[model samples]
Target chain A: MSKAEKTLLNVPKIQADFPILHRKIRGKRLVYLDSAATSQKPRQVIDATTDFYMRYNANVHRAIYELGEEATREYEGAREKVAAFIHARSPNQVIFTKSTTEALNLVAYGYGLKGPIQAGDEIVGTVMEHHSNHVPWHFVRDHKGAVLKYVDIDDEGNLRMEQYDELITKRTKIVTVSMCSNVLGTINPIKEIAKRAHEAGAVCVVDAAQAAPHLPIDVQSLGADFLAFSGHKMLGPTGIGVLYGETEALEATEPLLGGGEMIREVHLGRASWNDIPYRFEGGTPNIAGAIGLGVAVDYLTDLKMEAVRAHEMEVTRYALDEIHRIPGVRTYGPEDVKQKAGVLAFTIDGVHPHDIASILDVEGICVRSGHHCAQPLMERYDLPATARASFYVYNDSDDVDVLMAGIRKVQEVFA
Target chain B: MADLRELYQETILDHSKKPRNFHEIAEADASAVGHNPLCGDRVTVYVRLRDDTIADIAFVGQGCAISKASASLMTDAVKGKSRVQAHQLFQLFHRMVTGKPGDPVNTAGLGKLAVLSGVSEFPVRVKCASLAWHTLEAALESKKEIVSLE
Candidate 1:
């Protein structure tokens, strides 16, 4: 087959891997454009979790039976796979949490509260951060007496590097930002920002919830001291998230929760903590979810992150060109498709986002409409909300066409 | 099974485009703000009451077409009604939009408000249609707290 033919053929084959893509909603073929919120799991990921429960379902680490040993190996093997996926220095740096929100909180409390952040210290974040990354720092600022400064974004939703340079200073103990903005889809310069933060004696944290599923992530190359992503936002199940911290960074922080499997020796007066990753994981982890996430990583690896990214960029370029053809459609994010992910947040003139969303819903086109948990960003732009349509592996130009048709329907209904 | 045309009727579209009584009441006796954090819809209801009767009513805010139209309809419905009558109408309107399984919906007194009965089909939009009424209730009761349909 020709290269173009091969690529076009792979799109349907990729769609086949995701079972939910075939389902109908509201009697119309489902056009899921909200993958940035949470991606539909592939059959491989689903089967991995089901297989674990069906074959070897036992408590990991505590029990000494054959089933227990198998479960432990599978859980730890998942960690190793995730470590390799992110190119972490070792598997011991990967801490499992419920979601990206919890993972970010683990760092905010475990690292910030323990000692890294002190009274009057400054913590820098961006205006484009999702609430998951924003709210945790608010707690640190409110309780720890640290000053929280937000770097502004330009009209194109690109980070204002001048303001960012001013925001990060010697007193800045930590600088946290999202690798890719969930709303604007701006691909941030994490490696450059990490270098700047390091030069200023600040540890850089990255919220990779949006980027991990789209871009090729290398923690070592990115130089982020701590990185976090959710499994559900990728192709894995819910209730499983990864927090990849540098070995030194993980060792320096305290555990957020205290319970079984997290401690080495409980002396009644003072308890000794377990090793790096286990110490952060306080209780019985999400074994099934972890295994599922492992399989998801394997699946993505087989597809090749580069190819996936290329496909998304192609789809995004097509969407941008087509969506712009609709008069009165104002899209947010960089004009250059290369600078952003497949996510597109936009507003139709004279139409409320909720109304747009409802109109699209009738056509079985799922798009997120609201402030998108980034109220501060919404306030920054003086907008109530925006209708966001995001693309993923299974999505193609046809899905974008359906979305355009739905949007035209919204205009007609409102007109 | 829900129809979009039913939700966005002709009267609704008209009211949403040129909402009635969509200005601030300068000499307001009672006023309260209603906010729907989910969709960022906000409505401020103001009432100038003469004894128990609403002498004048107005609303000022930004929201979706349904919410803006509902607010406009609500102000027109409750303007001349007494406090008791307005409360009763609020209850009727609420039930109509919510479509409570057992509640009786009497639309005889609801003129333009009857158009909003279609909101019942779209359960998620009930909050949008009732935000103004909730604020009106709070205003009539002279509540100082902001009304939030969380």
Candidate 2:
């Protein structure tokens, strides 16, 4: 692949962004398709991180020095960019957490743990969700004595929207759902679900961890009270995630972790929270991480969300068509690729996904095999596991073709 | 084009296809289940013990060729060995998979297992290849003929 061909997407002109991707796995060029797990970084994001460490390395929100002020400015400024990226009302609404997993847990502990979830109250979730979204709600249900409600899925992994409509009722205080299914690569109708949740007098929380990276998300348009997404999945850094919540709703929720930077008046016996954003942030923040996230958002915006969504749909369609044609290979998720993200999960006949993955690794075609952390969805389909190849802006049709070739090779070996 | 020779050796492929001791034993002393939740490879190992020695062992579950074959070969290897010997084999196999003791490790008694030593090169696959052995270790510890899937 030429340098120009690699830059067909917004993956930067230089290879220095992520040094890790350059390393050989089994002596072949890595065709990494596991971006759904975490995306590779860009030069700008990586340099932004280094720029902080070299010039402005200081603990944020504490020092009176100039570096601290500069760091805080950049960090909070990054939050503003993230807020704008998802069309949040203000930077105050963005709470930086470790990952989308932590963000969801924050909601579970901070909000759901608080009383509207009574002994008989209900919280609704879909069958297709990453464990980050699923586990936290189950934790709430078990601890709070709340009834857990689940929405069914179609044969192709799409959620049964009618069943979801029937389930979301006045008794439902929390209607948390994934904006997209990680394993199925199915993009859910989050705006419609959010509207329904609002109509039913329940607050809607969107697990946008998968969706934020692949599609356009307008939190205002979606009308979701809270939205959660991770930085790494969006071509940013790990240990940096965004949780978008309306100020009023966030105020009602208690902070998940307790420490400095989250309090207002500290007394010997008791303490009071600072405000909306500070209430959620309880410790020294990841300053450089936020800057990397800012550059990532800038990178995504430069490509334009509309183009990103369109390109992925095209890639998804090509992958689905090509992989489906391979004899003895079965694909999961929507055949009509426009209905989903670039993620595709499938299995080879008489070949377990692990074996397929091992074969693919030799060819330097990295794809995720196994449950994709949605065991419930696998059970829903009566499948033990799947081989998943997800695409991002960095991937193109050639990558899919390479993957198709790899799959054929796997079949040949097992056959 | 990338050659499979760098990764999947001929011996590993053969063992994966027609794995030894794939059938269940009529009588087993203990059992353990091995699960790689990442790949959803599940194997339940059953062992029959005659005093301190493993009288017979069998495994049953759905997994990739590597896991199934690895389990099959493992069951056969431990069927008649003493429990202490089986544990040592498990440790040695794990170390071999993780690339310890260099290129030509002492396979002195490992026999057909020497074929799997090639798996050491493919780091990600080590888990898939070792799934069966992890269960074997679990089966040895518990007196129950059947144990929980790891």
Candidate 3:
């Protein structure tokens, strides 16, 4: 057996670490293929969260009690872990938010609205951005009277890089792009895109919500001024997300919310902002969720992201080959496995995506059926929606086999 | 949990495959579009009203089987009814689909729409079944804004 294939055999053992993977739906074993929406948590991550509440259960960075000290230590410890995970220079660059949506909104409100973006300035984005990434820029555009421009996708779902040459210029103040597409699983060349944006003297913001879960992300290597991702999609608890900004970038941007923890000293009408990361993290943060996310990061670090990516690529390649053999199935994104991640967005002839999802549900197969929060991408393809099956670390070849069977059942029922 | 067979009943499948009155009425007296942004399901409901009664009703759009069947069956059920009667039927259908688990579905006067009572078992699908009916109500009232079951 090949070295990669030999290591991938441990996938079933990895699947056993997740409590929900053992669940049965509709009298059949659950075949969860919707990790792109949100991933199932491992017992380690869940236990870490529960342990925080049960043991510490104290507000962070406020009280002088031992429990509060412990909570604050764990919370700040998580920031260090996140910084290391993304290869950031320091933990002070990381800010915790409720979700990736909130993180992106923070950037839009702080950097785009209050910082450098001005009237008639242009912001560049791609057609494949999630609404979280796309709409915030709209807010910037509407409030600042800035023009919003999009880098379109080609027939095979690849970004038209030539358009970047044409659209991005000195007029562009900010260039935001998703490191990976949520719907098409297109792995963008952010390094190249960021390079181009830098040449034009524009800051590059990356929406790494999809990419962070499956790929190894290095903020410095990608040259992202700001990067955002949610912990929930990467085997961690919900209500906790990370926003990494360079020191210079965070210093230039203002905080979106004002209150305790964000200000150094408040005197009636005047208040000085806190440090780089703390200034952005207003109010009491999701301390337990952050602690859990740190453990989740430790888990990923133990497994190594390269192995995870290789396993997913193998499963996706297998699924793509098998799906093409089915007469009526048309899968989206780049045909080459190397160019794509684990997302399989497909449509069946004469079958609506919702119907396919419903049938798959009967077989205890979980799949996403919707516009995937990328309505612009849907419009570009002239499609209402597509059935998507996304893979993660726990997913194996057996899961793909079950998915194939479920899809065949959908066709049979429709026939 | 309700069986998939119950949700995708033979009649529902048949209607979805070849929806009745699946066309736009020329010079529609009242028309409204319904959108389920969650699943990208869309249906445009058209009504030609004669005084207080519906003289004709047709629809055109793309949606899931549950939504398309719901819209198709809804058009048939309310075709000849008065505006008040159609509104009453909509209320009845809405309650039936949104009712809690094991709650007795008040199917009396619901007729063909009782088939959609299975939707209540699948709570996530409640919006899919109701999108068309909401659009129908918008059409009857001649609401210019598109109806949305967000």
For all candidates in order, the CA lDDT equals 0.90, 0.81, 0.91
- For candidate 2, the per-residue lDDT at A66 reads 98
lDDT of 3 by residue, A88-179 (tens): 99999999998899999999999899998889999999999999999999999889999999999998999999999899978998999999
Query: Which of candidates 1 and 2 reaches a greater DockQ?
Result: 1
**Model 1, A59-123: lDDT tens per residue?**
99998899999999999999999999999989998999999999999999988887578999999
Task: Give the true-contact fraction for every prediction, in order.
Answer: 0.75, 0.78, 0.75
Which residue ranges in model 1 land beyond 4 Å of their true spot?
A: A1-9, B100-109
- Ranking by DockQ, best first? 1, 3, 2
Instruction: State the lDDT of candidate 2 residue by residue for A1-415, as single tens digits.
Output: 2212323354443344567678887677778899988888887898899999999988887889999899888888899999999999888999999889999999988888873567778899988888888889888888888888899889988888999768987788888889888888888888888888888888899999999988988888988898999999998988999899977678678888778998988989999888878778898888888899999999899878887888787777777777767788888887777678878888888888878887888789888888888889899999888889998887777788889899988988876
Q: Which ten residues in a row have the lowest lDDT in candidate 3 chain B?
A: B99-108
Kindly indicate the candidate among 2 and 3 with the higher lDDT.
Answer: 3
Model 1 pairs in collision = none
Model 2 DockQ (Cα-based): 0.59
lDDT of 2 by residue, B87-122 (tens): 888887887777842355455577777667767766
